[model samples]
Target: MPGREARPAVEAQLLLASCKGGGPMQKRFLFFLALLLIVSLGLLAACGQPTPEVIKETVVVKETVVVEKKPVKLVMSFVPSGDTQQIITGGEAIERLLEEKTGYEIDTNVATSYAAVVEAMGAGNADIGWLNTFGYILAHEKYGVEVILATVRFGRPYYTGQIIVRADSGIKTLEDLKGKTMCWVDPLSTSGYVIPRVMLQAAGIDPDKDFAKTVEAGSHNNVVIAVYNGDCDAGATYVDARRTVEKDLPDVMEKVAVIAESPQIPNDTVSVRKDLPPEVVETIKKALLEIAQTEEGKEALKQVYEIEDLVEVDDSFYDGFRATLDAAGVNIEELAK
Candidate 1:
């Protein structure tokens, strides 16, 4: 009985040890299963959530730039009709006035001859011209130069050419000019050469052969001075050109006498190049018209060409003069050639 009891006790002891070992194994299994469950739940939650969207911010920088502009420059040319120095001074005054009126830079030039001014306009070297009547006509025919204004003198729109001689020279008629030295302003001069030549021809005197000597004095003032100084026996010029030298020679009016006077000739013109911008042409025309009404403008004009005022006119204004030239057998194209 003792041996049986002892066997039973040993068996019980082994069973107790088995139970204690089994308890630790069961706890480890439960802990591993719970960790796997937690990992699976976190993955499921991550799969249910939306993907994050990245936002980008952009910044723009602005820069400012500036450019400078230059003013427009216009060249105005003139024919030397009187004292070159006086004409230059007057031209500069006009330049200043126009610059103030138009806000454009103005440059002034006095050409050596009328044709030079016309050619400068045609060549685009000049934008404006103060042209004599015949010079304007020639420029219009050749380069389509346009006349915007005609000069007024003593309230008259027309002037006459006079053939001058010393008061005691006894050259009373155009016939007396034959076999005498003759002075002319220029071949292109309207009153100084063209009309006077026509007068000589009408008198049945040949200008080419009748004169003992011919001189081109280059300007109206020079022609008057030449006649007064006895360098020329007779000369042609604009009516009363002697007054130009009256200050220097007080006896100029007394010494120089008018032998004959031509018919009415249209006054000189303020003309522009053909290719000039229409707006610019209008501005120039308006400025000149306004300037003529000013006292300062009047004095400057007097110094330039003895201009009394400026009157607006068109090409038709010269038609009468053209007809006269045609009737006299004077061919403008031929003269141009």
Candidate 2:
């Protein structure tokens, strides 16, 4: 093997070239084999070193990962308010305001049904909503929606549910409503169905059974119009619902009368999906608060819900709604049906 040393070098070069080109699998396999051989040789060599004294302390290594923030994009929905386009036009203003103020991308939807809005939140299609108090509770209970803020109608943060009758209708009191056609708004409507039902039941009238017939008018305004036109003997709606139609039905005040009013209920809620970042919730609430401070903003708020201010409301504020539902024997889950 005097001049044969070059044969071993040539063999090594040929073996490396065989594994290197046009064959990733082969190359990787060879790499692992070589790594295993090197590890085995290293272990053999390490046996010659004297054993080191064991240290009593354990060392922990921490790793930090930096993730870039993604752009905040969301959709907002509201239960339909008779004028779907008006809600859109008004909601669009809030979208624009939010985009400008918080750098978020927002899309607006005026949901056809209150339950649809709740579904939107649960399905992750909607990140925020302008929900009536009962709608919020249903969404919160069923879908984990988190309350961000509440609306102030006109100037107060609370309003009453009123059962109104035509001004000239022979019906002067709740008793007169018995065996008469009654109009109710959506089932999800707090002021439209739940509160007025409670009022009727308190007066010894069963809305489901006593009324000659009951029909849904869809929205508060429709409930008012139904009574104004004598289409129904009586209808339930939020207080001052007649005022909302006076401009169109100029005799709205003269034609409609509030026969009974429910106790003051908490105002509608400005809610976000529970999974939303707290900062995003704060940003949205802040932008809405700022929206109520200017003339232009005031007009936008008015178009949405005649809102004058947005105030922070915690879960405790909505506890009364729960009590009312329980006391009336209304099942929150059944309403979803």
Candidate 3:
């Protein structure tokens, strides 16, 4: 009875064995083997076909090449003209001129303050710059800037400083400004402060110890307005600013007259970093001095500096400026202080 009962279990085992021997597993294995044989036969048949001798020839091939391009860049900066606002617009004109002359792209920068432009030069932000006599001196002393060209005023390579007062106020000479209020355009202004100070000293008056009150008007036009509006008894600015104020703001200009004019001071100049390549600097200097010969260049010069030409000048021209500052006993160190 036990053997007969276990007969069902034995039949089930035999069924499993039959399934393992003839299931989809065996079919899949057979199918795979047949496909592999077909692929092998196809490869053998393909190998029996002839390969062209021309196609089998060995040949050398060259490698591909590539090149990198460099970028062109230049930056020019200048302080605002004391009154004309020409320095800002003038910079744009000069940038165009430089591009035309050198075929190099340039970006122009304008500083509200001349000293700030000098700071840009020290920081290596401006590749080329325009600076007043005092600003140029500071840059040369502090940063070794090289002066390349200077403006010609009244057909001379230098300009003058003028102390002005209201035409009706009767402040007629350097002596008259004593014990009176005064407005100096800017501390770094050569004619506006430095040269005027020298003129005052020549008359035996000290600007710091003499003026009842001193104020910095920040621009030559502001200095003129300060005098015209009776804000100060006298105002000092570059002599050239008077002409611009007369042309641009005639009413305001008519109310003021020059009471005293300082001795000749070298005009503003264009400078480059001393470390620049001499050849490049020379090229730039040549273009600048020669600008007056071309129609566009002449127009730009008139627009910016209001001059017919610029001349190549050396640092020696500024020696008189330094001497004038010294003669007045004005220590630039004290000015900064």
Index of the highest-TM-score prediction: 1
TM-scores for all predictions:
0.81, 0.77, 0.75
| Cα displacement (Å) at residue 318, model 2 | 0.7
lDDT at 300 for candidate 3? Answer: 79
Q: Candidate 1 clash total?
A: 0
lDDT of 2: 0.84
Model 2 over residues 1-337: C-alpha lDDT tens digits?
3244444445445556667775798887766665665555456556657899998998899999999988889899988855667778888988888899899989888988877888889888899989999999999888889888888986778999998988888788998888999998888899998888888898999988998899988888888888888889999988888887888999899878888889999998999988988988888888888877877788888887777888888878999878988898888877655
Residue runs of model 3 more than 4 Å from their true location after superposition: 1-69, 251-254, 331-337
In order of lDDT, best first, we have 1, 2, 3
Writing each residue's lDDT as its tens digit, candidate 1 over 1-337 gives 3464355345544544455465787756655655565565556556667899898989798887877777878999999888999999999999999999999899999999988999999899999999999999999988899999999998998999999999999889899888999999988899999999999999999999999999999999999999999999999999889998899999999999998999999999999999998999999999999998999999999999999999999999999999999999999887666
Give lDDT: candidate 1, residue 56: 91
Cα error, candidate 3, residue 276 (Å): 1.9
Best by lDDT: 1
Cα error, candidate 1, residue 168 (Å): 0.7
Go through the candidates in order and give the C-alpha RMSD of each one to the true structure: 12.2, 18.5, 15.9
Q: Evaluate residue 203 in candidate 3 and report its C-alpha lDDT on the 0 to 100 scale.
A: 90
State in Å the error of residue 8, model 1: 60
**Which portions of model 1 show Cα errors greater than 4 Å?**
1-70
